[model samples]
Target: MATRVLLLMALTLYIFPIATATFHVKGSVYCDTCRAGFETNATFYIRGARVGIQCKERKTMKVAFYSEGVTDSTGTYHIEVENDHRDNICECLLVKSPIKWCSTPDSGRDKSSIVLTHYQNGIVNHLHYANAMGYLRDEPLPECHKLLKYYLADSDV
Candidate 1:
């Protein structure tokens, strides 16, 4: 009985940390140069863009966790979040764009929802990925109309 209790205690000690592991949220930010609402060949990844991770309580919607990060030259930001937020709502949100013309957050692509809990996600590495988000251009590029033709239907093209 004593041996069994010791073994159980050891197991719990080993598993507890893993269960509440820190998660690294990785994602990218881009400038929708064409104002097309989606990435195209003309899309440019924005360097030095500000990004944030926010988690709110599922029931009351009160903020529980928040962290901020900036995009590197490659336009990717890696933000580390501590603890498991299984019952909370988490999102990777856009904060700022460095380019003056591309400062507006894209309407539907402003934020990407993410799951921060390691237990339910089956993510062994504790690495989670949020979808890429983008900022919109003040005006469509001069050649955007021609470039956007490729994305249109046969009749529109």
Candidate 2:
């Protein structure tokens, strides 16, 4: 009986770590220098851009977990969600950017929803990718008007 209990305890320890896995979330931040509402030649990825994850409880809609991250030199921010948040919803939210001139979140393009828990998909080492968020330039670039007209003309057709 002691031997059976000892074997069961050893097996639980080995399987527990494998079952409770972590997921990695990666995304980038950029500067919409042209304010064209999308990326163009004038757009530039921003380094040291502040971003974060906010998880809220589904029932009461209360915030549960929040973690901040800063973009790297290449404008990428990688974060890990260790706890399973299947019962909640999490979003990658834009906080701020180091660029003073371009430091406003574009309306309707600020945050992205991400699934960090294994309940949706039972894959380990899961990688959740978020959309590239950006800040609007203080003033629209002159060339942006011309660029936008091109898109507008195409849409008018």
Candidate 3:
């Protein structure tokens, strides 16, 4: 009887894992023409930009799992990870851009860390928001100076 009870418990644990959570990482990409840190009126939401979510091994820092996607019409990309990433660290990173003029990833906003397999109050469950990443346009538009004034708090009106 004792042997049968132990076997049943082992099988039950194997069949049904303790953790049950899937993650949804959602974010957008943009083009920064003026070389300014943040978005301006001249900023453009880049459609079809390549974005990826990568989870690295905690001990070695080597990539363990990854997935990529192209931005939709609204410049948004959503990646769904099927397993719990509790033992690893993951981030949403800029991969590439389809537009010729805007192909350079902005160093400041290239990656955003995401926490999966958790629940927070007032926050959606199993959902992570990556900061909007941007690529630099080859050349800044002539009107960029005027449009950039909107983002400056000290600018003279």
Tell me, by TM-score, which candidate is best: 1
Model 1 stretches with alpha carbons more than 4 Å out: 1-19, 153-157
What TM-scores do the predictions have?
0.85, 0.81, 0.80
Which 10 consecutive residues of model 1 have the lowest summed lDDT? Answer: 12-21
Measured by lDDT, the strongest candidate is 1
Q: Whose TM-score is higher: candidate 1's or candidate 3's?
A: 1
Judged by whole-model lDDT over C-alpha atoms, candidate 3 comes out at 0.83
Clashes in predicted model 3? 0
- Give all candidates' CA lDDT scores: 0.90, 0.84, 0.83
Give the per-residue lDDT digits (tens) of candidate 2, residues 15-103.
45344557789998888878877878778899999999999999999999899899999999998877778788899999988888999
Error of 1 at 61 (Å): 0.3
Q: Candidate 1, overall lDDT?
A: 0.90
lDDT of 1 by residue, 27-113 (tens): 999999999889999998999999999999999999999999999999999999988888899999999998999999998899999
Better of 1 and 2 by TM-score: 1
Q: Rate residue 73 of model 2 by lDDT.
A: 92
In the range 71-151, model 3's lDDT, one tens digit per residue, is 999999999987877678899999999999999888989888887654322333667788899999988999887777656
Clashes of each: 0, 0, 0
Question: Which is superior by lDDT, 1 or 3?
Answer: 1
